[model samples]
Target: MNEADFAALRGAILALPYVRMLGFDIAREDGVLRGQLPFAERLIGNPLVPALHGGVVAALLHFTAAAQVMREARMARLPRVFTCTIEYLASPDLRDSYASASIVTRTRRFANVRVSAWQPHSGKTIAAATMQFLTGQMD
Candidate 1:
């Protein structure tokens, strides 16, 4: 994608209400899309474990996959999430978390994406997700 297209995608991502509420910041590195979820008190679901909420992590993974599809496919509109399955590998600590997505397959009508999330280190996965999104013709 061109620089202008990338900038527009970034703007759209940050403009999403839930992404903004979660303080998610997105960036691209060497053609790869990455996202960060800043540490927030509201994200803590289990007070006993004090771990980041599963929903929050799942949201991050979903958003990451959607953003990847939008950027890589150069789609003008965000695709509809058809289905998603997330696996929690480890409890995330009270710290910033990062996620990256890989587009596994893309057809005219649908795209499949795999996402991995980690805190502190990318080598260690906290959660993983496979998502399928309904795609439209690229503009």
Candidate 2:
């Protein structure tokens, strides 16, 4: 997706209370859909203590994958998560996290996507996920 498409999707997401509450802004672009996450001070973590919550990380991953599907399909709508799974590889440090996702495969009925989150300073993977999204009927 181009900047215009990203801007449109970003606007829709920003309008949501939950997304707004998370304080996420579009950080980078891969195409139409981009990645975002909470950058709040409370999102920071300690090496030996509670790190970024798994649920939060999962949310980012889920959003990333769903965003990709919505953008690539060019269906003029946001896709919802049918299901997703996140495997925590490492904890994110106290820095702005990074996230990205791409369409790995797609079929007439289903699309597969891969998403990842990381701590930029440490280059540690906070989470990785693969998800299946139902694009719904286009016609």
Which candidate gets the maximum lDDT versus the true structure?
Answer: 1
Residues 1-139, candidate 1: write the lDDT tens digits: 6788888998888888988999988788887789889999999989899899999999889888888999877776668999898999998988899999999999988899999999875457999999999886445
What value does the lDDT take at residue 18 in candidate 1? Answer: 87
lDDT of each: 0.88, 0.71
Where model 1 places Cα greater than 4 Å from the true spot, the runs are 121-123, 137-139
The predictions' CA RMSDs to the true structure, in order, are: 2.5, 2.9
Query: Cα miss at 128, model 1 (Å)?
Result: 0.3
Clashing pairs in 2: 1-31, 1-32
Give the winner by TM-score: 1
Error of 2 at 1 (Å): 3.2
